[model samples]
Target: MGSAAADALLPLDASRFAAESCAVVDFLEVYYRDIESYPVWPDAEPGHLRTLLPDMPPEDGESVDVILEDVRRHIIPGLTHWQSPNFFAYYPMNASTAGFAGQMLSTGLNVLPFMWAASPAATELEGVVVDWMARLVGLPECFLFSGGGGGVLHGSTCEAVVCTLAAARDRALSNLGHEAILRLVVYASDQSHYTFQKGARIVGIPPSNFRVIPTLAGSAYGLTADSVHEAVKADVADGLVPLYLCTTVGTTGLGAVDPVRDLGEVARQYGMWLHIDAAYAGSALICPEFKDYIDGAELADSVSMNPHKWFLTNMNCCCLWVVSPALLTSALSSNPEYLNNVGGEGAAEVVNYKDWQIALSHPFRAMKLWLVLRRYGVAGMRAYIRRHVDMAKWFETMLEADERFEVVVPRRFSLVTFRLRPRHEGRDDMEALNRKLLVAINGSGRAFMTHFVVDNKFVIRMVVGAAMTEMRHVQDAWELVQDKAKEVQATP
Candidate 1:
């Protein structure tokens, strides 16, 4: 190669790589150390980041030192520090040293294990880790590879839902004929994630066939078997086939848990697929006390949960297990001349995860979960979860002590939903007041929280599951909330 051509090529020298890697690690360490000093939510508005950089890609590669400086000055300010202990908005995106190390290893290797033979070790490791997770969470053997069922990792619960729904849809259509696709129906409570409806639409289930069963505040937002049964009965009477039923364990808004066992029975009556989305609450099931929440998971056709939510794993890792792998593979598997058929004759022995999800290309996400499990053993993880739950209880106790605020719903897991009590008589606009209070709190940048409206009432949701969150941080957040509440209340 010519000197200029060689110079233009990206550097792969071992020494330089190591130095740059170390520098990046140093920057990460400093960021972690000082994360609490920064705002949980950034003050930047839309299109603010475009002004920080040139419109075009860099003409030449720059040193890591220079790039790191740019990240500190320009990028960091715009980022919402999801890792900050003060961040209580949405669900926690937990990260740990071990998970980060696994991420680095995966990035460095950059191998795609779409098929078993594409990367044997990667595929085998994924099987091992997913099995380990299933066992740790006390899942039934029916959901394990050893028991004829298996699991695959997807980037998010939405992808998992889409894949499972496709499987269910195809299975029903196969029996009822393709013409029945228009008549196939899907069901979920109103509190269920919107992903189910999106999945239904993607899988060709008609919009009118999507049934949203309403739950009452009297039932604490839990989806009851009677509601699902009634919905299914109505659909069946209308000549629509019930193809799928989705239940939630720790719903997003109020942390409501659908009665899985009863709902499973209702689904079984009509031969409908039962899916349990335990995205945020599944990690808590590793603790024995929370096991009852998923007592009927064995009856589920497929179960999905996001390890990225609260399992101390980094961004984007969802584990999905199914009682029947053939259904998923039949619906999603695609083989072409360009792609090698690794599982030639005895395909049952091999697991090509590419067939079990929506995407053909996937990263080594199981590595991070494996690392998190190994680094923090089942006992350690249980303790971590317990600490967060205890802190949430502490926060709830504080809220109860104050007459100005009311707990909107019973505390479930580590999420506490509460709102200020109405101070005036004959007022129906407390929603506006609560909205203003939430705005003031978020605007202050002391701590960040998000709101949810349940049963015509607005409530602030405080999730205490960040890896670095401790009792002190929770206390500080409560104090900030109290101060903000007073300021908002004094306004009129």
Candidate 2:
């Protein structure tokens, strides 16, 4: 414990490891205990942390205690406390203590299960956990391991979209050959998450090959079956091949739910692959009441949802289900001499997930899903989903009571998008006013939320998913918004 030379800390022994880990654990306990008191967003501009810390890593190892001190001093201020009770921005990115423990366990094991022979337990656990997830959500057996298709955990929906698109592309190319790759087209609603566009680009699909079909705002910004049918018709008339159709269960900006059942029929009729992206609202489906929203998705070729977005799991974990595992593996699998293995090939029926996704080495993400599911049983999980939807409905009622604000979109799950309509005359600058109000609300540091432009109107999006968020916090946020809007309007 004395002030020894930096070299003394070079190699951490077991005692030193325990000391550092214990110190950090103590720090985390205090940090989460006081999370509500912290600012949701930092006042410091960019480069604040870089300016405060040393320009380079220490030439010699430093004591973990010293690093901890620097972290508390410099890192804490720069953090935007997404875990705060008032963080009603974007989707409900909720994380629980169990999720943290699961992540720590995964980090400890650090197994590379690229092949079943590499680690049988790791591969099997993922398959089992994914199957459990599918069953708990009432997904069809076609997407389960017992069926030919199955699910895998990805870092995000972007990765899932890209992987599934690759599979669909390869399937199309098998029949149409490489020249048709340019003619191959993917379709999504305008309100769809930008991830689909990003995925299409990553999969080498031409920009012109991707179609951005506009959704009707009057119908809650949902992509209609008629609109898609027409788009496909036009594409076919021009000799363009329709490759894939992406239907979203929950859109990002407005939380729109495209008509999946109707769209699926069109995709089926056209022989195009159907992929459903439920990154945000998928967690709601766990509750039986919300099962109706995804009724048509069972027939789709692929589907994905993110527990990290709303299901009390940590960040960066997405669960993807495909109706055809053979198609996915065939497109992605590369049998290099170095990776040759017979464990899963002959009699063993082991599934090496490396061939199912872009990455060969996947983290044990199933631990978080397993841990959270165990901590909150099926009943508890359903109750959690119901609480958020109920909270969202409550917020919507509050907005409706107020005459100045208009709910731009229908309440879907926990996301509520509303925009301000001026009660006073001669104030056509509503968009500018809402922007100013949003700036003031965020600047207050009492709470933090985000805004979006829907149907050419700026709207505030409030998502209630922080595990600690309560009714009182929601009420307080509205009061703050009303005050902020008044301040903006009163200004010259």
Candidate 3:
């Protein structure tokens, strides 16, 4: 440890990093400002990007200017602009500058905070922010850390479903014996997201054990208690246990909300676990007015929402709350001695987030949560959500008033499902006709929408909540839709 040797410190040259970062920042600013000019969806067929780019990675490093230019020239054309105001297809993947800032900062830090001891500030702040969100959604105390329940942020609603379903699976198996796993059933409405069935597959639930109950337009496409009860009763009569019931607060295709209290009673009847998956519409619950959609959440063993989808957070953040953390921790915790914290079991209340999900490693997701909450405040979030819902209703009204069109299910949350009505009594090709109308509407380039089949009706879905969406965009979309519908009708 000679003074001379120690005095020779490492050189700190960061000019390249500074230049590249500045270039990226400038490009982002310009891209966001001029995004509306870009087509919301690409017209390119498959293999466009692959055919245009090099066959393999280059041996030499590319210049920053060259890379940035390539991004603008090649990457830009191939991408769908989800952030565009006129992009109303599927659901809004709303993101804000504040959330982007959090993402950038988190990536720079690049620390793995998978446990309290790994990065205490990140872990604790995650808990605090998640609790803040729980309150925002009007969740019961049982879903909070203070009431023996806690939250963890997963990358997607799919991951949340898988983790919670896995927890319920293990718990039910423990009590009923693992052999009975083949006979245990899971229940969800036909309109629910397809992720539940995917989860069932991942968790090894038998295909025969799933009950995808039919939902009708009369019930607004939601699963009813009676349907669930009859399914459970039939299974019980055959000596099968009803293991889990997933009631949605805003289903994917229809935005239909199941009767949570009624379904909860059905779950309770057979001692089954009730989990709520509100990936798309759960963010609306931040507004007190929308809280009725989740009236019986207290009876739920778990609940999840995608902040990335509607809460103005970017991709890769779904907050899942479990009433009893032990269920998941006990099922998924596989921390070896090497991965253990210094203080072991004595450190009781500390959360090792690694035990909560399938993956042991995760990004600093809480940063986005903290920043979004701080920047907008709950009031701003509520207004954002309400505005989208209002716009959806406006579009629904426009459809209902027109003689050529019909509102399919009334706007549920920020999604309006409607279609062009059949022109004649004997002509029942509305599905094919509406399909052409969708293509024309999207081809116009001013707006984009999606569709789904419910009760054999071809319903177009116009979902609001793009970052810059407003009344003008909604009205323009409606007008274009009406014009295109007429052209579609006149075609054949």
Whole-model Cα lDDT per candidate? 0.90, 0.86, 0.87
lDDT of 3 at 156: 93
Instruction: Please write out the lDDT profile of model 1 over residues 1-492, one tens digit for every residue.
Output: 566866777677778889999999999999999998887788998999898899987666677899999999999988889988888989998899988988988888888888887887888899999999899888999999999899998999989999999999889988889999999999999999998999899989888889999999888899999988888888889898999999999999989999899999988989999999999999999998988989888789999988899999998899999999999999999988777753542666778878988889978887888888988898899999999999999999999999989998899899999998767745636887789889988888778999988778888999999999989999999988888888877787
RMSD, each candidate, Å?
1.7, 2.2, 3.9
Lowest lDDT sum, 10 consecutive residues, model 2, at 1-10
Winner by lDDT between candidate 3 and candidate 1: 1
In candidate 1 the C-alpha lDDT for residue 75 amounts to 96
lDDT per residue as tens, model 2, 158-188: 8899999999999999999888888999999
User: What's the CA RMSD of model 2 in angstroms?
Assistant: 2.2
lDDT of 3 by residue, 75-183 (tens): 9978888998999999889889988888877777777778877887888788888899999999999999988899998999888888888999999988788888898
Which of candidates 1 and 2 reaches a greater TM-score? 1
Candidate 3 regions exceeding 4 Å error are: 1-14, 343-345
If the candidates were sorted by their lDDT against the true structure, best first, what order would they fall in? 1, 3, 2
Which candidate wins on TM-score? Answer: 1
TM-score of each: 0.97, 0.96, 0.96
Ranking by TM-score: 1, 2, 3
Error of 2 at 387 (Å): 1.4
